[model samples]
Target: MICFNIIQLFVILKLCSGMRYIDLKSNFISDGVEVQHGYFMTSGKYKMFHARDPALEVIQFGETRVFPDVDYTPGTHSLFVEQFKVGDEEALSIYVFRMSVTSNSVVYKVYFHMSEFGYKLIDCAKFTELIKGKIHVSLDLSKSKSHPFFNIHTKEEHGQSTTLIEIRKSIAGFRLRNVEAKRYEFGRIMDSSFPIYMGYSKLNMFLTKATSIFIHKEDNRKYIVLRHWTKNIRFDLMTVNGILAWNAITDPEPSLLEDMHQKVFRLRDRIDGYRALNPLSTLDLAENISPELLGIEKVTGRHGGSTYALYHLEIGKEAYNKIKFVVNSEMLDMLIAKIDDRTLYAKVEVITNSQRTFLIITCLMKIDLVYETVINYYDKPNMENTSYYHVPEPYQTKIVSDMYKKYPVLINMDIDNPPSIVDHGELQYDSYILKYFRIKQEDGRGSVLSGKYAFGDIWQKDLHEIGNIPYEGNKRRLKVIAHSVNSSRIIVKPKNMEYPLLPEELQDYVIIDG
Candidate 1:
């Protein structure tokens, strides 16, 4: 009986596993004509073509309209037709064409032609190919009004020839061969209103639908506008929404000015903090100081024209601080040519102290003269000078260290391995305790110690074989010392190139030697 019960349990488990892997398909059909299996109607002036599916109830052909004939090739004439209901009644229809099937999926070429003008079915395959990949169509029905219309335009490359039309209407149901089908209900409405239809094909898998609303209000007037789009649809929805809401409020006075003032204050505070940290970094010097010295100057020429020169300078820390505080203040409004060289110049800014700003301005002044100590000789000479000033670094390092201390190091255990040394400190170590016998001490007193004290062979093998342990206790501790170190190891001693043994394979693996 026990054996039989076990067999029954095994069978039940197998069935459950099989059930989890099952794929079910639901079929839906609407009151429309299918266009896959060929069908024809002879009761009208134009024969209606449709598919053999029972879900598609009626098929009617729309009259073809063409523009004025022009002198063109015989086969180049654009020809297209729409299919609709016989009595001009509101009805939905889907046009499906079997192409090819592969693997477990069937491919069909679909086009959704609506009765509304300017509505044309977007070819899924062609659209996917244009996008360079397949994407599923996301359908959004929340903002749909009466039926959604998709406008599509197709044109051949390098040519002006094209065809445009409005086809199929009142698409209440649709289905793919050997796949699932969906049905939509369109309740009683005017002859102009019909159910919404969505076209899908194997090639176009990714699609999205979105909706938007716009509102405008002024004085006592209010306007609400709703807009929606699917991967197959397009239209602009709104310019603004809060405009109407603000107008509706009792107090409509603009408060944006006050908000702007508050934002400015906050921005100023942030800038002040940044400037405090980077005291020597200056934008004013880059804009005003350098440009003034490097401005164009006129030399000897038939036409007096300006010539500009580029100059650059790098200064040491001591000179950087002095220039920062003195040059800007003493020569704020001074002309470049009078102070130093006026031809070309540059300044190098560096951070020295949080409280002190620094700058090193170098200038190249040029003078153009046509003359000579001897007759029939001309010479032009240019002069350059470099200078800088800034606060000392002993003060800067102190402030930087204080700022670093403000943000303490936080150890993250979620990482595969913890940092070896956090904030310039080593992690605590635990000794491994062993349960075996112990050796006698020099003073003739013996105590419990690791098994390695007497059984070296067994202890060594156990240390290599045992996996990582949480902690070492007095009783079950191994004689070996296993340290829980962080991943980033800065080895200061024995730097000659020695690889440290990793803790264990299961715990962590080292990707780099550190």
Candidate 2:
């Protein structure tokens, strides 16, 4: 009976190893740096502290102040930490420390408060002293809508920097990815490592250890995949779920993959069938759609622009979802010029027939590739104008009917004439309209198409303004601007990197009084 109790006690101790700590004072040392008056816990408690770095003696002169309870529940894996006040001034004078713990590491995101006292001490070197390393800051002030963001990097390895905290508009978000302690040439000790590779869906998650499973989210769709990589070899394949049990297999069976893929196809069929039975006006469907259904198998080739990369995925026979990834290289160059590390603009799009497209995301891909935050193109109205007009003759009607046969019809206008929708002056037509364009490329100063085109043999080549009535002093000017057959989204590489793709009000004239 004593031995049995002892065994049970040992099991309890093992289970209770992960304990929570708060309000504990410890002038403890970690990685050879002194941490004072902060919380402490067991070996694997993922230590998070909320005390003023006593080493920050320059600004520590004030009345002793306590902080709110650190509301962190280990079971739920919550990411909530309170701030500690230093000065007896306003709330802005307090130091907000948001610490995040993953499977392998603990990250401290220290923000020098937004108060008058805190704002004055925004010095890069001084802030580093408050922490425990020689840190570098990257300030991105490119977007006018959003304020500058500071990326604090730990300069640990000789001539190498690893990001620790990202301070955006006063909130500090910590990321501990591949951090290793080392001494720099100037005797400054800090954390450094290779740039972390975080996928689209993984933005909501933080992993300290190298992850074999990754979740990718695009266009309101979520997909799970298994990926493994070494110095020279890499393997990536889609999976149903991010289950560790399935990942434990040394090698997945071909039959297992085939069965899983067939099941995914069946799921897509069920979703398509449901949509057909109950059609909706909004593109945001009611049914939950998995990204695994419309998965991007591979990247085909490069599009016209230097920054744009094209990827292909098979939706169905004769139907495709051509995806385009736009990376602003010019802006990246400017960022490189300004700071050692620059923020990159990475956007993804899904293009189908007849300008039926979706803007998946317009986000900032960090230079380290550790994080990506979606850019909300401020609250603007859905500026889209759609109209329907009938074709006069059998020839034109036949041409329109062929395109209509390829896709579902929408009788929105209540007109005998099938309507054509125009977004920002660009005419949207079906895949059958592909015969109306001719693909070409630029040769010298005057060029036809920067990319591929498809033209009908019946029409004569002429320059014409496609959109609306322009205000010409006394005359109307008809000029060919650009054309794309495969992609509905316009691709324009601006010489000035600061130019934004703001929505322009269409100068369209629609006759309502028929």
Candidate 3:
């Protein structure tokens, strides 16, 4: 309780005085990397210790401490007091400096300091001066070759850069590039769905190809505003120009910084809200969340729309075992959902927000190896045995010819014959279609017979017709090659086969070869 009181007192004092300093005992991590305790020189005294981390383009400090005898006065330090730290863990503080590549050289200045409730910008002397007899890292300016230059004004004849100055700028450029590359690398490793363009710019008039940074002064304090745009979202960070300070997102916005700030804060709040829920398990987390919480809405269809979220959930013990989920608003009118236990189960809905269909769902099971199988209920059988398409008369013969070519036993008897046109008794042509038929024998084997009498027609028809009609000559039978036992359906070959007449029967049967 005493420690808490002391901390509270310190915070009140710091706020009242507006003196920024770091508390060195707090936990500190920077850019996903842990930072060690360190000190900065102030007024020729190494009295301040700090923990620093790199965030975006600047280094933010926390856990700051000051030695005894240092006057803890607010608004007293010079803007260019060499350097200092304003890190406080419990204060949610951030303080930093920034570097930018100008046309002639790299410029350095104190950036901004920010806390949970407020932010401040410092205005100080900007410098490009190099330390004497020192060498710095070289900038690979070639990386910006593919980048275009825009609205750049360079004094070609006024002066040439000294080799020392060029070297210094190159070193600064390398540092900036390293930071950018590290950021991209982190994004790639995490497979971040949102593209992060750190210092991204199409035009590279400067070595850094930095996006435009705007400076504004309000209430005698200067602010440096930085802008970045992904395809779907925009972001901006505002910091003090000369002091190690920055305004919180809650700070009063200048009109130019309004929209992007709103968007970013909205998203940040959403994420923070979910994290605050602190589910004990994955299922609990999934069950507790809704689409709206992630900025997703009931979309019309499955086409193009902005995605609200994309994230992965771990389901197994393996280091790489995880499932990805993506939520998006679609342009389509139907709401569609598919579920695979391994990762997702999406529900699709119609434009009216009505349930349309439940797609197939697969469940992933872990055994010796992870495997997936469709649930039985979701796997419906194809309950159809009818022709899939109607063939045109002209194409029917060609189709039969192709089928016969593939299977020689499948004879094309009417390959060249077209049905003769009836001049009389057009209604009699319909009589040939039997209304119903049934097999008399219990062991109904091959095809059924449809002829009137095999007894009388045995001598009139050729041997092929008689042989084709099984059980011929005595009781006489005509094979019903294809029968609709439930309904009287007839299938007369190559001719009728092309456009087969429906069987007039009452039973359902499909011929299958043994």
Give one clash count per candidate, in the order shown.
40, 10, 49
- Per residue, candidate 1 scores C-alpha lDDT tens digits across 1-514 of 4454643453354244321110001111122321111111212111122322221111212222111112322221111112222333222223432222322122233333334562244554432222221111122222232122222234444433232212122222323111221211111111111111111000010112123323333444433222222112221111121111111111112321233233333433443443322222222332322211122111110101112111222222212322221122123231121222232332322222323322323333344652211101111122123233232556556644643442221112211122111113232213321121112221111211222111111111121112221111111333312222223222221223344443553124222212
* Candidate 2 structure quality by residue, lDDT tens digits, 1-514: 4454643443343236433222212222112121211111111111122222221111121221222222433233222232233333211112333333433122332233335433333443443333342121211111112111223334345443333333332333333221221111111011111111122111111121211333333443333333222211112222422211111112233422333334434443553444322111111111123222223322212122211212223223113222222221212111111111232332233322333322233344454657555321111122243221222355454543543343321111111211122122223223211111112243121222332322101112222222221111112233223322233222222223332323353112221111
TM-score of 1: 0.16
Give lDDT for model 3. 0.24
The local lDDT score (0 to 100) that residue 367 gets in candidate 2 is 46
Model 2 vs. true fold: TM: 0.19
Question: Per-model C-alpha lDDT, please?
Answer: 0.23, 0.25, 0.24
Write candidate 3's Cα lDDT for 29-81 as tens digits: 12222111112121111111122222112122332332212343332221111
Best by lDDT: 2
The full ranking of all candidates by lDDT, starting with the best, is 2, 3, 1
TM-score of each: 0.16, 0.19, 0.19
Clashing residue pairs in candidate 2 (N, C-alpha, C atoms within 3 angstroms): 388-419, 435-456, 436-455, 436-456, 437-454, 437-455, 438-453, 438-454, 438-455, 439-453
What lDDT score is found at residue 165 in candidate 3? 12
